[model samples]
Each structure stands twice: as structure tokens, then as C-alpha cells.
Target: MAMLNQVSSQDVETLYFNHHGWLLGWLRRKLDNSFDAADLAHDTFVRVLRKRELEALREPRAYLCAIARDLAVSHWRRQALEQAWLETLATLPEPIVPSLEQRALILETLEQIALILDALPMRVRQIFLLSQIDGLTYPQIAAQLGVSINVVQKAMVRALMQCYKVLYRGG
Candidate 1:
């Protein structure tokens, strides 16, 4: 059992030697940026090492591809979010624009909020977005969605609870 759990440094080195080039090439084709591809390839191996599932992997390439794919998707989402934020900032007056440090902090917070919001159920997320982003009152949202005000209120409560748990309680 102990042997089943333990993968030696040599094993990791062998795995990297065997698959690194293939993984790098896969990422390069997927990302169209050699630098980002290289970074994701390294991140994939780091994830593999941290997981300590080397001995259990029946198909190393498939496992690597799955990790790399998730990383690539997250990379793309973050890039899109940053681009949107930058465009919004561009519309602001120069004097009111955030400093570089403030911008980074805001971006990070937005990413966390996006992740939280994405985890919400479809109806709940829709209600939250309508209320927050569209500035619609509960009655307005209920009318728009053809749901009762009670249902909309309940969904908002559920969504806010999810946010509270994840953001405040670290759940």
C-alpha cells in the first residue's frame, strides 16, 4: 500500500522526459502562444507532481491533456475578463483611473467573484445578475422572468448564501 502511494523522483523525471515534448506541442497548438504554452505545460506537470497520482495514471497523455485543457480554458477566461476590465477603464476619466496596483487588486477580486458567480445555479445566477448588473428590482426580475416575487427573492437569498460561504467562511 505504501509502495502504491509513493512515486519516486526518478519516476517523475522519467514521466517528464517521456511526455514533456508532446505536452508542450499540444499546448502550443491549442494556445497559439509558445510562451503561454510553455508556462501551461510546466503548470500541468507541477499539478501532476502535487497530485501524486503518477502511479495510478493508466494514460499519462490523457491525464496531461485534461489538466492542460482546464488550465487553457481558465487562461482564456481570465484574459477575456482583463480585456473587458481594461476597456471599461479606458472609458473612465484619466484622473479617476486606478493605479496599476489597484487595477491588479480589482482584477483579482473580479476573478474570484466571477468564479463564485459561475458556480451558482442557472436561475440563481440569472437572478443575481439581473439584480446586480441590470439593477432590476425583485418585482421587475420576477415580472421579466415570469416567476413569482417570492421565488426570485428565494433565489437571491440562496445565491447570496453561496457567496457568503465561499467568500467569508472560506468554504
Candidate 2:
């Protein structure tokens, strides 16, 4: 995809003039924060403009909503991940905890992991959490989810590959 700055000025202006208000209102309703809604509305347009086929769009609002919904899901995932990270931090012994800068870097890494998790299918994601977060063995996870051991192992491999790509490949 093209960068936001690469989008043509006239095209962006036209799209903003035609859809800005409606999209902002829609995001506001979904986000419940005027600032965040406004920011996401701008980002939605940025993503839309960066697409290669904007001129061919038959229904712009529908497309805009599709992009906005994705952004909303990402926003919520970050929020949930941050909350969980903070809770985990609270449980750590303060003397052994990392410094503030280290904590920030660790949180950024966790955010990437969470995004990878988001891309996974529901069953694969559940299996990953059971194995990683809940510390279950592969056989235990397979039995709990009513799948064969082979299936659980396959899901775990898929999840690990996704995480590896995000962590090492800048995906």
C-alpha cells in the first residue's frame, strides 16, 4: 500500500469534504471519545486514500466503514493488551522489575504479539492462550478443546510462526 503522504491532494480533499462529518460522527459513536474518533476518522481516510482502487469505489461510505471497523478492532486490542500487561506488571516483584524504558519496550513487543494474536483464527488463538498464558500442555489443551493432539500441535506451530514473523520480520 502507498503511504499517506503519497496520496494525491485533490483526491484526499474531495474525499474529506464529502465524508468527513459523517465518518467522524460514526467513529464518535463507536469510540465514545471526540478526540479519538476524530483521529481515527482521519486515519480511516488516510487508509482509504492509500488504497489503489479508490476511484473505482461504488459505495464510499461502506468502504470507509470497513476500514474504520478494522482500526476500531486494533484500537480495542491495544487497550485490552495494555490492561493485561499492566496487571501482569503489578504482580511482579518491584525489585526485580525492569526500568521504565525497558518496560515501555517490553510493552511494545507485547503489543506486536497481541496484533499477531488478533490475526489468528479463534480456535488457534484459544489454543495459543491455553498453552502460553494458562500454561497447559499440548495434550491437556487438545483434550480440553476436544481435538486430537496432532491438531493442537499444528495450531501451536501456526501460532508460533505468526508470532515469529511479527517479532523478527517486522510484519
Candidate 3:
């Protein structure tokens, strides 16, 4: 078992060595910063090693590249979300201003929430935004939508379930 583990480790190391540069280069083409590309490349290898069936990856290079690409897209999305959050913070009232560190924390949380919200269907997302962000009650929302209270409650529950699924998916 020890020998088998050693062989597996060696295989993963070889895979990383052979593909890290190519992955970085691929990421660099899509991203502006070499450091960011390198970071994503390292993350890709980390994810690859954690997989239970790395040996089963027939086209390892392609698989690794795909992982890196997904990471790159996620990075871009997070950055965009953070920027938007910062802008929103800047527009808040002076007494409600957040410190720099607090702003970062809030941005991170909002990004996670945004990701959860994005997974929801369009009407579900609208309902959730209206209820949570706009602070609308079920009866108020129901009246606004011309739906019954029970329908609004059901929509809220569905939206909440979708958010929970996105949050707990271990992405």
C-alpha cells in the first residue's frame, strides 16, 4: 500500500511538472497578469491532486486546462462582484460607511450571495431580491405580483432552497 501511494504521488507530481507551464501560458493568454495565471495554475494542480481518479484522466492536459479555465472565469466573476460591491459601498450614507476591511468582508459575503442568487430562476430571483433586499413582506409581494399569499410563500421557499443548494454544493 505504501508503494502504491508513492507511485500515485509520483504520477501526480509528473503530471504537474509536465503541464504546469502550459496551463500557466493558457491562463496568461486569457488573463492580464502572469502572477494571477501562475496562481490559477497552482490551484488547478491542487484540485487535480484532490480528485479520486486522477489516473483515469485520459487527456490530462485537456482536463487540467479545462479546470484552469473554469478557475479563471470564477476569478473574473468574483473580481467583478467585488468591484460592484465596492461601488455600492461608496454610495452609502456617511454614517453607514464601512471600513476598508469591513468592506472587503462584506464584498466577499455579497459575492457568495450573488452566486447563490444567480443559480435561481429569473422569477424566483426577482421575488427573493424584492423580499430580502427590498424588505417586502409576503402579503406585499403577493399583492404586487397579483398572486395569492400562498403562492408568494411557495416562491420564497423555492428561492431559499436554491440558495441553500448553491451554498452547500462544495464548489
TM-score of each: 0.84, 0.82, 0.71
Best by TM-score: 1
Q: What overall lDDT, based on C-alpha atoms, would model 3 receive against the true structure?
A: 0.82
Clashing pairs in 2: none
Q: What is the lDDT of every predicted structure here? A: 0.90, 0.86, 0.82
If both were scored by lDDT, which would come out higher, candidate 2 or candidate 3? 2
Clashes of 2: 0
Among all windows of 10 consecutive residues in model 2, the one with the lowest summed lDDT is 1-10
Model 3 residue 116 CA deviation (Å) reads 1.7
**TM-score result, candidate 2:** 0.82
Residue 70, candidate 1: C-alpha displacement in angstroms: 1.4
lDDT per residue as tens, model 1, 48-155 = 778654556678799789999988988998999999999999999989999999999999999888888878999999999999999999999999999999999999
Stretches of model 1 off by over 4 angstroms after superposition: 1-11, 52-55
Clashes (N, CA, C under 3 Å) per candidate? 0, 0, 0
The residue pairs found clashing in candidate 1 are none
Estimate candidate 3's RMSD in Å.
5.1
Residue by residue across 16-125, what tens digits does model 2's lDDT show? 89998999999999999999898899899888667665554567788789989999988888788779878988999979778899978888888777778888999999
